[model samples]
Target: MQALKEAQKTVVSNAPSAIFPANLDVEYVISFRYANGGQPAQTGDSSTPEEQLEKLLHTLDLAGLRTVVRDGGDGTLLIFTRIRSEKKLLGEIYRSRVRDWLHGIRPAAPEKETQQSIEKEPLTDGERLRLVYSLITLPNSEGGAGITPKQGEWNLVQSIFALHDHDFNKKWLKDWSTKWLIGPEDLKVIRDRFGEKIAFYFAFIQWYFIALTVPAAIGLFAYLFLPAYSSFFAICNCLWSVLFVEYWKRQEIDLAVQWGVRHCSTVQRKRAEFQFDAEATDPVTGEKIRYFPAYRRLMRQLIQVPFALVAATCLAAIIAGVFSIEIFLVEVYNGPLKMILKFLPTVLLSVFIPIVSTILTNFATRLTEFENYENQDSYEAALTQKIFILNFITGYFPLFLTAFVYVPFGEILVPYLDVLNVTVQHFGHDEKYTTSDTGFQINPSRLKAQMIYFVVTAQVVGFVLETILPQVKRTVFKKAKEFDSRRKGIDTQTVLDPPEEKKFLERVRHESELEVYDVTVDLREMCMQVSIFKRWEV
Candidate 1:
């Protein structure tokens, strides 16, 4: 909602002593409001917000911020500053610059023409922004100035700058879809606006999408043209999975270097919930650091093995029960309304699996906390691994059972279900349906059917759960709360002490909701594509 101003810089004509590619140019604002307290106030300087803004700018100058200021009205101010190194120029000389030097070793006029040509060509600019937002978020020695906008000097800071431009990001994504490719520059744009964490996810997935296409195309061909349930296809798919996983590890490192986040984990702050046992000085940095027993944490992590087995067993039992009922209804049941009843098990599984998975996911979070990871990265990784495992069992295991177990062995096993015919009778059929009559066979193509539903239908369901359901729940809750308040004769509408705060809040309110829902879409697409390949092989 904030009207975004493009962060721009003028071209530098002069050279500098050192190349600092890591340095970033960032633009941010700081806003503050007067403190309101019930108790008698202590004697202090009663400076106005405008006067505070002037003082802040002076302090920024002292802290080496070459800032440009503008009035933001009320208790807010807009401050723009370029985070540059002490040197005038930033970044290493590209190889192109060296090539230009080689050209200069020849004739002067030719060298000048080569230089002109190089200069004329448009090039990617801006040093990798590093953690520009982070640098501004912390205290100076700790890497940031603690001059963040949402709060700083007073208790009434209204809003931080907008995280993104809605229209621009929409257009950008539209163009990306039309082009079917995301370049490094596109990822850089995301990093500049949102932050590296989200951008890293995008980058990893973009590479994944591109890599997946080769195998996907091959599998589609095999599914259509190769023999059904081909062992060759299975082997190829397995090989592809292994190759893809290994390749992604190298790709992660490449992206880390490209984003200047190779050392990012080292600077990451301690988790807010992290409890410390002791403190010691870092031998190299001489900084005091919190200490926790790694062995104790590892011992706690050992609990996950049994917990995971229990979760997987519960999910597998659910899946197996669904599969047996489905196979029975389809292959053995001669009961009333057979077609309708055949789908009931699937429908039931669809409803219950997500519910069960949610409960297990909540449990996984507590288990992850028990592991007591030192950094956010490790914590999230472990948690994601747990979710992936839970989903693998809950989502894929049922289909696997149907494809590998039920279909292949239904002839040997399903005949026993004929005993139910004594209790339940079919309306249309006169003859008792037996294993011999239908050959006790379930179609291997049922696997393909399941894959189709998983790929197409599962996506719709996930989108609803991830995007629509949350919005609907929030809206309904808000309305119910408002209605309840009205019944109590209490106002629920937000009221700001200062009028200026209203505009800032309005701008930021929309900005705060600009999360990339496409992330879910992308992840689900990749997952289903992987599932399709694996299922097709079976």
Candidate 2:
């Protein structure tokens, strides 16, 4: 039994990427080693992951049990290590084996024994084309279907557990669609990574911009004639932006039609994405409910209200502190410190805003757990809503206050010779206080200041918050995991524990997972830019 395990371990540990899939429903042979230590040969699994790798080792008999996967068993393991190459090998095995079976199943003529029979087989171009086309068009009768090979057959063959991956998506991706978006390709990854909501967002955006001309026009007009303060243009732009957003919402449904996603009957009748509550996988479909309706997602959304408030509080507090200091130094202070004080508000606000904002965002992240979204949509909707709130408050709120307040309040409150009480010495002559409404003009530099704040200061802030911070955090977390997993790697006591030669494997599973949220972020960032004409005007 021990020797069998040792051999099983060896066979699995070094299984080619062409053997079986991660979601093994059918098992195919992998490699055969003559118990006498002869050269090994590889085969494929036409069955599932269990039937194939779990088949008791070097001795074909049931000499021992080897776990095909580890932890949750949704994936495959070689020996005790969770290597993912088995799926690719399995896919190749499935294809080659199935193709051979198909060839055998096709009725063929016995070897032509006589000249008379060989002469009767004269083939014309038209007949050859018709026969060849018919043969190519036929399906595998055993499974009632054949694998649809696409351009990336080599890549697909490496994913032996393709069916499992597909099945996983087939079950979960359906329910996940409504609250989020999805596409034919992403259906599987969405089920695994962020769930349905995030996936649905992708599907929706892809579906949304099938006609992109309309929004482009509105943006162009806003660039051309719409002065920054034009009430008509402001109303039009705001209304238009909102209308486009709303229209896209409806368009998603219409699109859900042309692209095939509107009604979620599949998700509705299905299981939630994560069901820690369920005892075992279901019998009929062998899958638990992996999703739910938007109402539950909305329930999760309630958590965002406080998050927004907290973000607003943090943002306002930081900006107000800076504003107060700037106003006191510029307007009230008469010390020679005027020049030095000019930079104070910006410097202090820069530090305070990020610190406060970071704390609030952490608090907001904790709150997202309460969102209880079945798929990525409800989850991401709540997530992005918080993100948008942060963007708006940190980006727009300070400018709004500064634009209206600094001049208006300063003009009213600052000491000025009142026109009604002009000095007798100057009564006959025109008199004006340099501090009066007319002289206390809007700083021509204020617009430039605002723009600089965003372009330089705020941009640095954005990079820290979004890109640098997250990357640093990930690197730290990944290093910590590597250290811990190291000890686990050394602790195995079974025969499979012994060292064996390893072949080259190119990538890690799930490393290149696709995302729709990333796309949305890019588009929104582009929109946030000062339009081209606005920049040129500057």
Strongest candidate by TM-score: 1
lDDT, candidate 1, 1-538, per-residue tens: 1112122233233322011211123244444343222122221347555565566666565444456543343223345454443222222123323333444421212223333433553222222222333344445444344553433352244433423344665777787887777888888877655556667778777777787787678778887998876777778878888888788888787877775455445444444345568889999989978868988888988998998998998888888878777877886776557769888986888788888988998899889987877666677778878877886786678677876777778778877777666556433345644223555666767877777778777778777877798788767865786687678666444444256345544554433333434353355446755765555544
| lDDT value, residue 86 of candidate 2 | 30
Clashing pairs in 1: 138-144, 139-144
lDDT for model 1? 0.58
TM-score of each: 0.64, 0.41
The runs of at least 3 residues in candidate 1 whose Cα sits more than 4 Å from the true structure, single-residue gaps closed, are: 1-163, 211-213, 216-225, 231-253, 263-268, 282-285, 416-439, 496-538
- lDDT, residue 3, candidate 1: 17
**Local error of candidate 1 at 240, Å?**
4.6
Alpha carbon lDDT of each predicted model: 0.58, 0.42
